[model samples]
Target: MELGVFLFRPLIRNRADFKQAEETLKKSEVWIRNIFKSLKEAVFVITPDRIFLDMNEAAQEMFGYTKEELVNRPSAIVHIDHEQYLEFGKKMEEVINKGEITNFQFKMRRKNGEIFPSEHTASLMVDNEGKPIGIVSVVRDLSEQKKIEEEKEKLQAQLQQAHKMEAIATLAGGIAHEFNNALTGVVGNIELLEMRLPDNKIVTEHTEAMKSSSHRMANLTSQLLAYARGGSYQAKTISLSDFVEETLPVIIPNIGPSIRIDTDLPRDIFKVNVDSAQMQMVLSAVVSNSSEALGGDGRIRVITSNEEIDAEFAKSQPGLRPGRYVCLTVEDDGEGMDEETVNKIFDPFYTTKFMGRGLGMAAAYGIIRNHGGWISVDSEQYKGTVVRIYLPAIEAEKKVKKEIITEPKLDIAEGEGTVLIIEDEEMVMNVTRAVLVRLGYHILEAKTGKEAIEIAKTFDGQIDLALLDIKLPDIQGDKVYPLIMKARPNLKVIVCSGYSIDTAQG
Candidate 1:
């Protein structure tokens, strides 16, 4: 009886151990199944022949199919095409040999026939003997990631372009300033020479030629100054639609008779504060660009509309702020530009046309930016190009007064008062002195701000007018103005500079 009891005890202990092992195995299976289903990324289990064995909820949602529908079906149904499936099969052989494949990017198709970019990391599932039995893969959709990367690159490009344009504007402003000073001397000297020279046809012809050449050079400098944002002489709040209507006739002849011009200037369009001349130049540049793009016969549409830029929209466009704006759209149905060409269109000296100076668009860009606006261009090869200029809109109720016009006298008035000329440039000073002396005004000269103040203090004669150059050697002209005013309380003053009034004040 005792021997039988001991044997039974050993049997019972063995049965208990076997039961415990079975329960542990069940727990592990549940754990693994839960992990597979709970994964955020799409997971797939396939047979050696690439038949779908099992899939998680994420996989079903990713492929737009139910688990029961995809099970036992060929995995090729989820691939972009049959050829891509075959290519994937070839890659599976490498996976089998290497024990796994990681980060294999490819295009995938959904049940509704939509193809999107995807990346999958697959591992070889093995049997007890380590023989490849199937594949288990985790997949991630790359469409959003790719989109984010593209946006980042685009923003980087825009930032780079802004920096480049800023540098160019600084250089251009400096050049225009110096060039305008030199031109002042040339133009002033020419005026002096014309007055002094006796009547001779040959001399008159040569001087006129020089004057014409100088004027052309001055025009070129003006364009550079426009590109540098220093060309805005006067700003007025005006209806954009009315301005466009008034200017289109002048632009039409230059566009040529071959091309047709269409305009949709709505009466209720918003008003903007801008220099009329500079705004006209912007329109001309844009229209001329479209005309040149047409190359002979095509339609150019000029349209005006009100736009509201929200914060999200403004975030995508560099240097743009969210606000109400008036949009001027110029669209052309002609030979368009490629992505590369469009990217460089606003760069100074960049052009597609033969012998083109390429300053028009660049100057237009600067003008709009200086007016607290922006320009956007969209183009595709052989399709069409659309340029949108956005200017800040003012309240509709604000009254815009019409500018008064008067005819010019056409003659330089002879001056009788004593003039104080404060200039740093020698050529400018000499020509200016010659002009004032010729005009019958007694002149007092000073090359620096300190010298000008000293002359204002000690000069015995009454200094009636002080022509102050904004840029001076020692102190700024604005600073010197108050000091000289303190010294000569009754003196009148005029501020002169190549920069815009806003810039000079700044």
Candidate 2:
């Protein structure tokens, strides 16, 4: 009844037929053995009886079991949780019915009872009549792939930090230039008012009132400039509720009239080491940006919470360290951002505006980063955007003044001493001379650096001080300083310019 196969005996034909059948069976065994020898992943099989049937070199290495132990014993030394291994039986049954299967991801146990990620694929073997027999699996291991992905994300965070620093540098220069020029006008008017009228008179009283208004305008402009400057914060302990209440008035006006702002800041005495101005900048930009999104008709909600992040938890967050932080979140119901816009939002000069809406949140990115803080945004198009700012906190202590500082005002001397006021603009130079004359100091004014040297030579008396403009019509600050020093070697020089020291060099 047997055709080409009978376990121990050959086919019933002749002696040559018997020998040929034996040779064919021997060749097949050699082919399977050679294939298993070179495999890198664990390869083996289990019978329906749960006995160790056959295993390749990888399977033997993985299990730490010899061929003798595996050929007859159950594959239990590698898999400690032997009961859970029954799931493989269900997979095998499916493969047997299907004849072939695709690879699947799963966890597997090593010789040391360690479970790791792996994948396996199986095929059903059959007799010539196509009756199902057993399964053959090809296994693969996956630990190195996950490590590469983590490194890539860390590099991206560092790139984002560098971009934030560059944006602050650009914004600060522009703010200082414009705001200080405006302040010069303010202080110039106040100085003029003092000379024209005596104290306590009606004329002097009105002049003083105008001066107060100008100073208020100066203060408001300074606050907005600081928002553009980034990270210049006076950090101290303050009540969270009070901070919000104080910030709301300034921020609300920046938002649109159509937007209804809501707040839920706690009245409890929760204190943190935050720069009030820097925090205000963060709140203003985020809320204003949201209002801009809503087309002037929406609501914004601001909430604060105390959160502690352990080392394990912090590692999961992008660019965050393990510590205590006060989380302030701004939520707005508006037309939110898409994936492309959100990714590039923090980049300098990269804006959603068509031509020039200006640096809307470019400065906001710098302010938070400068505070050693973290900011993240979640947004969906036509839905909303939630911006979260995490700031480090410290314990608040009772305030105390250690000492008092009082610098005495020097009494003005009516001297015949010559003062050379070297400034680029005629308006600024004329104002400087007027202020000095009020103090009874005779003045020699020059509109350019070249003219300044000529005035010093023709001075009627000794040149006392040179109020040199760091920026000049003919020469730069550094160049002018040396020329003036060489000419009037011992002259007392007071460097006065609208630009900050950093900007003067720039």
Q: Which candidate number would show the highest lDDT if scored against the true structure?
A: 1
In candidate 1, residue 310 scores what lDDT? 93
- Tens-place lDDT digits, model 1, residues 1-506: 11112112222257778687556556666667787789999998877688888888999999899989998899998888889999888777778888856558899999999998999898887654677777888889999999999999998998888898889998998998899898898889888888888586777888899999999988878888888876545677789999999999988999768999899999998888878998899999999989888987899999999999999889889988888889999999988998888888888889686216668998899888877789999998778799999988876323222221222233337969898999999988899899989989999999999999999999998887787888897999879988998898878776666653221110
Superposed by TM-score, candidate 2 places the C-alpha of residue 303 at a distance from the truth, in angstroms, of 1.2
Clashes of 2: 0
User: What tens digits encode model 2's per-residue C-alpha lDDT throughout 91-127?
Assistant: 7667866777746766777756777666777765555
- The per-model lDDT (C-alpha) reads 0.82, 0.65
Judged by TM-score, which candidate is best?
A: 1
TM-score of each: 0.87, 0.50
TM-score, cand. 2: 0.50
Residue 297 alpha-carbon offset, candidate 1, angstroms: 1.6
